[model samples]
Target: MFQKVEYSGTKAQQYETLLFQVKALTDGEPNLIANLANASSLLNQFLNDINWVGFYLKDGDKDELVLGPFHGLPACVRIPFHKGVCGKAANTKTTQRIANVHEFPGHIACDAASNSEIVIPLISNGELIGVLDIDSPKFERFDDEDQHFLEKLVNILENTIN
Candidate 1:
């Protein structure tokens, strides 16, 4: 049996709580895939107005991202570096928050209902590991605060992954 947590307080506060949950979840996990899978599940449970949540892991031998565990409709399995939101985040080592996926140049439509998106680059020890991607059906669903907290969440991920 498990206890359900009701996320309360300001958006930032709720996000902080989520971060703590992430740390707790990955505290001693050394398996990368398991951690990423759980992280995506946590995001799907915590977030609203979203159509997709998942990871795009960097394929070390290739210049591309391979889809990891996800919670949503089927998605593009591989994204070339710099090709789309996930790719841009991987290529630039920066977060990509798109207010309107339709307007973004070369946007990849994994789910046609996703209007907005945010991608956080996952780097461990100065090496690019992958990215955490979240999508929303409504435009501008992600704000600056969301980006800040999600980045912090990724920070926790970078440290926990082996």
Candidate 2:
């Protein structure tokens, strides 16, 4: 059975539990679909006020990202590597966190309700495979703490998915 907990836990505690769940969900499982789905759910649970939690998988030959497992409103199914926050993150292989979506160059407003976003590139064996993207409706909704937490969380996925 799945047990629920208040979101009052410390960041480290929450992350630890999240990682444990990830391990539980992916252990001995080799399906990418299942892995990404569990990852999305884990993020949605750990973060606060997030409108979107999901991944944009890279299409190597096409140089684009396609929406993968996600928890939120419908999103852009395909985005060029040069467009939007997810694209930029994949292009630069760097995480991008924007306090205001309007200020982000080439911001693709799939959901008008989203105001802030953070995209963490997913790399395996030093090759970029996808991005873990999160969106919020509140401005300045994410901070350095979020960056640090997600980065660490992504590290946990590296071994499971890579």
Candidate 3:
């Protein structure tokens, strides 16, 4: 069982706590879907000013990302590689931290209320597994610190999911 997250610490400390919580939540779980579901749920509970948190898994033998477990309103079902923010991150295998979704070309409007976004590519053993995506209602909601911590979170997921 997961405990309520306490946001009473420095940003880095909070993320460190979140990282451990995620590790604890998914530890020994061999089911990928269950891990992803709980991972999204954890992010939804720990983060603030965010409207969406989810995963976009790479379809086997395909160049598109299929939606996976998520905690938010309905989202775009399929995102081709190199298409949107998620796709861009998938293609580059790098984190995309957009301050303004409206200004990003080819940005998919899954939720009109989402003003900023972050997408982290999940890589394990040099293979692209998927992406961890989050959206916020405020512009410039994500920054370098967020990117760093999320990358760490993704690292934990990669080690445990498979």
* Per-model TM-score on C-alpha atoms: 0.96, 0.92, 0.95
- Model 2: lowest-lDDT 10 consecutive positions: 1-10
- Model 3, runs deviating above 4 Å: 1-3
Q: Which lDDT tens digits does candidate 1 get at residues 76-148?
A: 9999996988999999999999999999999999888999999999998888899999999999999999998
RMSD to native, candidate 1: 1.1
Model 2 scores a C-alpha lDDT of 0.87
Q: Which residue pairs in model 3 clash with each other?
A: none
As for lDDT, the candidate ahead, 1 or 2, is 1
The digit string of per-residue lDDT tens for model 3 on 1-162 reads 556856777999999888888899788988878888988998999899999999999999799999999999999999999798999999999899999999999999999999999999988788888999999999999989999999999888898855
List candidate 2 stretches off by more than 4 Å. none
Candidate numbers, best TM-score first, in rank order:
1, 3, 2
lDDT of 3 at 78: 97
**Candidate 1, residue 104: CA error in Å?**
0.5
